[model samples]
Target chain A: MITAEQKPIDEIRNMIAPYKRILALGCGSCVAECAAGGEKETAMLASALRMAAKINGEEVIIEEKTIDRQCVNEFVIPLDDIMEKYDAVLSLGCGAGVQAVADMFPEVPVIPALNTEFMGETKDQGYWVESCIGCGDCMLYYFGGVCPLTRCAKHLLNGPCGGSMDGRCEVDPDVPCAWQLIIDRLSRFGALDRLEKIYPPKDWSKKEGCGPRKIVREDQQK
Target chain B: MNNVSRLKKVLENGEFAVTAECGPPRGADPESVVKKAKLLKNNVDSVNVTDNQTAIVRMSSLAACALIQGMGLDSVLQMVVRDRNRIALQSDILGASALGIRNLLCLSGDHQSFGNQGQAKGVFDLDSIQFVRVAKNMRDEKVILGGDPLSSPPDMFIGATANPFADPIQFRAVRLAKKIEAGADFIQTQCIYNLDRFETWLNMLRERGLTEKTFILGGVTPLKSPGMAKYMNNKVAGIDVPEELIKRMEGVPKDKQRKEGINICVETILRLKEMPGVKGVHIMAIEWEEAVGEIVERSGLLPRPSFD
Candidate 1:
């Protein structure tokens, strides 16, 4: 899942104020579960926009549409007719959905209503916390299902830093020390010996900041 | 306090208060609704425009309130804090007040599961009690969440909901007390069918010393038909119609069921008026506003006290 928080309603109202005909698009995938952009949020945004327009004494036409997955081409294709009708599209999906909409509807301006924070899961109802970084590597096996690369504030791979106090990370007292969690998990799994093995420094080039990464499944390809 | 204080003064002066509810259309067309507002302008003291009743999207509450106010009607803008954050809610309150919509009903609202957008995410940032607290905070201290005094705080009457028929009637008083403690000035209860139960709940409120602090408006919604009675019984939570009343509706012919429903509502209101704690009655005719005049007249509440 991708963690996101909705932008302030006033900010969203201002962003789409210029367009008379606007389509509030939502994605039912990651953002829906996170309570950022989904079908419900799209309707809310549309209602808020209409209210804001009435207050400003401006006439605006707003339409709401939600796709199962706006990050994929299959979902974006269904919006072709509505995309042609609207002057602008306000995407409530995550960053990927905005990009996909933009790619599909180059003629219309695509705006985002959410700030995609990180990849995470719903810790509970109405609460989502970060869990993974998608670092293009599998380190959870060695760490016994804990990924220090993502959970650690400093992204420390081997062990906890000196800043760790009472098993809590110094950067955020609420958070447990990622390396400590890693050690606890490994010991429980009878893999404590893995920590004694000196692992080589991770190559930063394979991460997201480098460039666009691709994975082609030869078996599935034509 | 401005207009609300004035309105309170009018009520205290023994004026027969009048209020009408304006249900927004299901779509964007506001002409018919505005026409309805015009019709009620001469009859009611204030028009209570609902905010997406049942959690379904409609013309916004604020917009409808503004339109009614613009049409020369005092507006009681209904607000549901189920979807808005503190900032948006406060700003909207201020905005509506600026547009001359003074009265407000603070509601937690129907859950989204009952609406067309059941899968839609709901943002219940603050419940009814918290909403009243926020409104009172803005009114008394003029301070917001960031501890900054607002330039001009809104002067709006805060109203909350109470249900006598809600299972475990003690919890209703407890929640009502909480709302009052949170600074709710008034309460509009769920539809009252059982007058004895309602009076008992009122006595409990008096025993708890809550009756003196807040004004309690007994809610009265006339059932249109047997189907409506069944719908309220099965679908609406916290509202339990007595089996006798259901039997009455079931016994009546289809064409005469609506008349029976109105008679039941009028009888309930008359009984409620004789009760000590009730300040007035809020008639929720649902989609049957035409029967409201008859109910009010039948209850002998007509020739309402002059505000002018």
Candidate 2:
């Protein structure tokens, strides 16, 4: 899932200070699962903005609303009527959702309240770890379900770099050496021979490096 | 392969080759590299110009190699996969070949976070193994990465680095084997302070007959001081400086530590000369280029072989 965290309140406050009427929007999908831009977070953010405005002797009117998924245009139809009422929208959705809403409401400014982090999984109640980079091409099967492109700091394909020691990455001790994890996983499954075949340089044009990417599915299109 | 590398010729003739490193200046001045190259001109077979070693910015290795080549010294163009993508890398390889640089040392450089620039995005477009294969393909197949024919392919010798001290010790030799299979003609390792561990790695190579496939050059670096030893042991990743070696450095007087370090380096080189599968010694002076000549001379590798 795409994980994100709320931006500092002061920065968010400064962005919305220019407008008197503000809308704190949230998304109920990926960001909601991570407890970042959910319904409760949107309400709390709205309350905080109101208190901040009261302390500053401002007359800012902040309202809260959340959609099932802000990335979807159908779910964003509810905001069409209310978006005209606000001077600016402080979006608590992920980067994609923020841009989606901004694309829909071309007039009002849509400011993001959260920082999009990475595509990762919830490791624990409060901890999250990145697992994928959405590199467009996946080679996890040969690596025994571990993605070296995303996990390894250097994205080494042949084997581990020399910095790995005691199964920990030299870049950060807290992070496990991705190649070690790959080696161990493959070793356990008796698939260690899979690494004998060298993987070539990745074609990064498939990713966003080249430009904006899109998938046109004629079968699924209206 | 049309081997144009002088270093490869030295190794092929059954000579114990001696190579040293020449780090480029942070500034754009060519004189600084010339000064270091002058010190190592007649003392070693070839000099390796590091490409921003440790991620710290320096003059481009290709330009530095050209500078040293003008001084009548062979140069090993150290190419790291950290800063360039496949296009830039292949272009630079051709550029070096065009400028008469015959050697290449392919490496996945130190992470950018370790360098002065923490915010720079690392461009590991090709890992070192893939880099070796790419350079090999460009040289042997006369084709670019996409299989398009190169008008003139590079006739270059390829080198790669190995760290026997890193974790999963048993797999270090296997990694070296992968590099050799990827067309690495020679291997230069991380600086060696623990001979037993190095021999253990070499034994693994010998067992797999990898020793016969490629030339192996043991790496050595003078410590300079006890603090430097401790820094390498604690701070430097992939380097193992034994505690006894540090104690030996600390055993000497503060003013004499540099001399002691050189002595230890010379001793290590002499020992490496006798080890099986060890074809040569690469002295990485690490900003102490003047000491390279003394270390090499004391190890009795003087009067470096020259082919007219």
User: DockQ scores for all the models shown?
Assistant: 0.02, 0.81
- Clashes in model 2: which pairs? none
Candidate 1 accuracy as lDDT:
0.76
DockQ for candidate 1, please give it. Answer: 0.02
Candidate 2: tens digits of C-alpha lDDT, residues A171-207: 9989999999998999999998898778888888889
- Write the residue-wise lDDT of candidate 2 on B1-308 in tens digits: 23367899999999998999999999999999999999998999999999998899989999999998878788999999999989999999999998889999999999998998889999999999999999999999999899999999997999999997898887787788899999999999999999999998889999999999999999999999999999999988888999999999989999999999999999999999999899998999999999998998999999999788
C-alpha positional error of residue A72 in candidate 1 after TM-score superposition, expressed in Å: 30
After superposition, the stretches of candidate 2 with alpha carbons farther than 4 Å from their true spots are B1-3
TM-scores for every predicted model: 0.58, 0.98
Which candidate gets the maximum TM-score versus the true structure? 2
Which ten residues in a row are the worst by lDDT in model 2 chain B?
A: B1-10
| True lDDT of residue B251, candidate 1 | 94
